[model samples]
Target: MSNPLGGLARRASFIDSVRQEGCGVCIVDAGDFIAREGRISDKNSIQLRIAAEFMLQAMDRLGYAAANVGEGDLVFGDSFLAGIAEGLDVQLVSASVFAGGARPFAPARMFTTAGITIGIAGIAWEGFTPYVAEHSDPGRPMAMAATADAMREGLEEIAGADVKVLLAHAPLSELRILLADIPGYDIAIAGHDTNMEPFAEPELAGATRLVNRGWDGTHAGRLDLTFDRTGALIAVAGSAVLLDAAWPDHPDMLTLHADYLARVAAALRDILAEYPVSPPPTGTRYAGVQSCVTCHPVQWGSWRQTTHALAWQTLVERSRDYDPECFACHTNGFQWTGGFTLYEDTPAMAAVQCESCHGAGADHCDAPLLPYSRPGEAACLRCHVPLHSPEFDYGTYLPKVAHPKAP
Candidate 1:
């Protein structure tokens, strides 16, 4: 996963550079600031909650002016959100989100910087109600008003401001229609389109300039606004900066990250204890690397020379050996029957061993003729997905680990 701490550091550096150039900066998030939109599960709930808390704290430290309320933020319910918001320096705004027929956050917020007032209004898509219904707490049910109605009301509320911006947690098509119909917003920052990639140029929805930084904190959208002597908006330029390894990690964010990791590790240890590993049934049990070395010495030696043998060591070096997500791919038969559980508890299954590719060898060892699984494209693809192994090619990668059968 991409580290948010690194992204925050880069953002802080960018902000400092802009301010040093004698330009005023107003930082705001379009939406989805709490967590990613998905079902909450026992395995991930702890990590997600901790991550959300860290994100809020980091935003406060960065001095964010405002952030939109996306549907994902409702996963923890209104009470949890309210508790967190109470301690935040960032203003959370949404024109549509309501509970008990009343809006939970401000309809819009105004920020004055360098003698110009900027009005920002937040709006969530009406279609996100289904997501909220499925994942959100049933006790504190929320409703989304009509998008057009919300936009009109929000625009009317911020009419007196010099520049009007819409922070919308909706798709581009929806924003286009609303911006065209509303006809007032000078700029619109659209979120919720996960598939869209960040672009340098902004799209026009009527007269409003539309921009989206995409998801996952991989990039930050930048807009340079130029106003005339009368403070009337004259020109707008937009671009996106990639948050990569080039930027050094900010000291403060690094400290926050370490604290988050330590807390998550403790929570994971408890979760693992609650759900202890259950051994697989007879005939399909995983046989460790040592069990196969005697029978197929050549294959065992070949495997030891490959990167798969040292996968667990890589996680250990990075202090992620205990992380279930990272361990699943790095170790042998993770979460499977008789597979890896805790690192210290199951040291034999530490790395991708012979059984990781071939089927569990208990039956194979007992009866040599019994069919055993051979490594194939399907087997490799399970771990070599685009997110983790983007350059993986079945044809080219297969040869690197090819081993001869017994003569």
Candidate 2:
């Protein structure tokens, strides 16, 4: 996966080719899968299984035969994910997950094809462990030190079996440290670095290659290496592969994704969709002045008269604008890194409008629901007050927000 743009389709094509070529492919996921914006949450086993299956199928759609689950995965709880692992054909390898008493999970798993044994193991950052006891058994989050200790065992197994590669899932900061400390493996795959660019790092322990695949399977790390008849390294693997470009999407996985995603989209559409609001003058929807006219007409009127009307102007082309802490309060619309524009009001006429101070008017426009119109003092305090302070001077803010009375 290279660029996030056109990520899903491109990745599908790339992996499909790999599977067709019969080249043993390893798909490594670093972490943070469940903590995403679109993550589906459910209490039922089937629903949880469906969510996990959806993510797993995406990789399976590509040529990855196995994956090491990560921290964000903990958002769904251990038992549910573990159940998901049980249902999938892929292997779950993580030194950080401990399930004793004939636990269905394995700490590390080896994939063998054509007499070559390549074992993949996983260990998450110390902060990634989740709290839970799933499947009617006692389970505990593997501690960092304990996880490291367990990593040594997994590495030992790799050495004993003479596995050629090591795949891992953990934070980038921790992965760097591990690559330096553990020299038993030939290659290290990294994850949990949302900003990672999927490039190789300087060699560590005299003989290991380390790389990161950008999150959400947008970028895949592709390397070409050589081995002797006995599976000994002849030439080091080179060539960086990001899934952004043209690649094959596996057929089976696509079928699986199609089957599950159809259902997921159907169920989630109602919650996620933002229907057409009689769209405001600028195409952006604000709660409108009407909702709060009775309670705060003074403030609303001042807002109507200000330059803040074109709030979206600040957002034109700024997707990386970071969070809207100050700009959103003093201005209108929002600031995205891609730059802001008043889409609803039209660039020429876009102004903050009366609803800027109130809220999006779509819901309450038909009914003046007091609850949705105003968030009270707390909502205004985010930008008005100091961090971690409970006290806010609404009186001081009121002066700035509303026009001064006639002298």
Candidate 3:
């Protein structure tokens, strides 16, 4: 709830640079403005309206326009986001999502800063299809395939508006396909998928430029495209930089952080009072993945990517799926040593328990997170290029079986 006290320092330097380089400016956010951080809570939609208020204030002073909601936008549910969106001047662009007949959210402004027109838009991962369906009958679905079509259609419609920018909150895989077709998509921004790639990790997937800013606002990316009055791509300048110790601080951003901290303190006090924590209660369910690894390193280290570690997230993102068999394998919470005595019950989510398959957590848990357990046929069948478990055998596939030691 508390923001970094050093936020002011970060914002100050960034702002000073912008002030001197005044020009067309546009700012975009990759959704997730709200959330149940780390899958721990039922609902934790932290006053997105407040976050918006602070962000817009910074934008106004810095000079810019527009931002879109990411899937995390639904953390508090639709009605909540809609309520918070009021009073903000930035665009809440997402074509696939709608409020009745009107657009999901958007603004008339195309942010121009330092001679750049950032055509910003927001889209969610197609995987969210299940939740959105139950929430709003917008009749507009963002299927991976359908989204590609939407992007093409949107380009034709928005392109003529004299705006030459596009932003999306789709997954990396989906973005890859969208980028494959160029001219239709000039500059694309993405959320949902985290990427450490430099600016616009673009593939001339045909013609468009593609990039993802990763997550948690640790870094910001920019794409500056120069187009003729007719909207033909002339040139582009893009950069992605880390918001580390080196980045200059922003005084206003810091002030905003302090205000957020004060409010968080008051709200948290009330929450604690209402849901007072009991001393070591039982029968409780938690994401629990982070806690176990701390004590059981050797076994846990290898399981970081084990199928189980990946299981909870998959279910979190896709619980609506009708895969009963899979539903049982996945869990909201779990206990390892106890075993799945009750298929319908919560399962200990020790994050893949590389130990479970690897046999024991006696070793390897202490070292690195990379390829913790030596890869083997068993691990492979648990995940990637998975096959029937019966077909896999340890004698055949050794651990650390990188590059498919054998077929």
Error in Å for residue 183 of model 1: 1.2
The list of candidate 1 runs beyond 4 A from truth reads 1-9, 273-285, 354-368, 374-407
Clashes of 1: 0
Please give, for residues 1-407, the per-residue lDDT of candidate 1 as tens digits. 33322267676766666777887788889888877685345566667777778888888888788888888887777667767778788888899888756677898999888878999899999998777656545665788888898898889879998999899999888889878877999988888887888664778889998888677666778899999899899889998876655666677877876787788788886656544455543347776888888789998899889988998998887677767767767887776677788877889999988877775787778787877777678888878865456468899988787777854
Q: Higher TM-score: candidate 1 or 2?
A: 1
- TM-score order, best first, reads 1, 2, 3
Candidates by lDDT, descending order: 1, 2, 3
Candidate 3: Cα lDDT at 76: 47
Evaluated against the true structure, the overall lDDT of model 2 is 0.52
Per-residue lDDT of model 3, residues 129-156, tens digit only: 5655554534543222256554654565
Please give the RMSD to the true structure for each candidate, in Å: 3.4, 11.6, 12.9
Instruction: Give one digit per residue, the lDDT tens place, for model 2 in 129-185.
Output: 333232223453333325466567668756645454555566667766766776677
**lDDT (CA) for every model shown?**
0.79, 0.52, 0.49
In candidate 2, what residue range of length 10 has the lowest lDDT sum?
317-326
- Candidate with maximal lDDT: 1
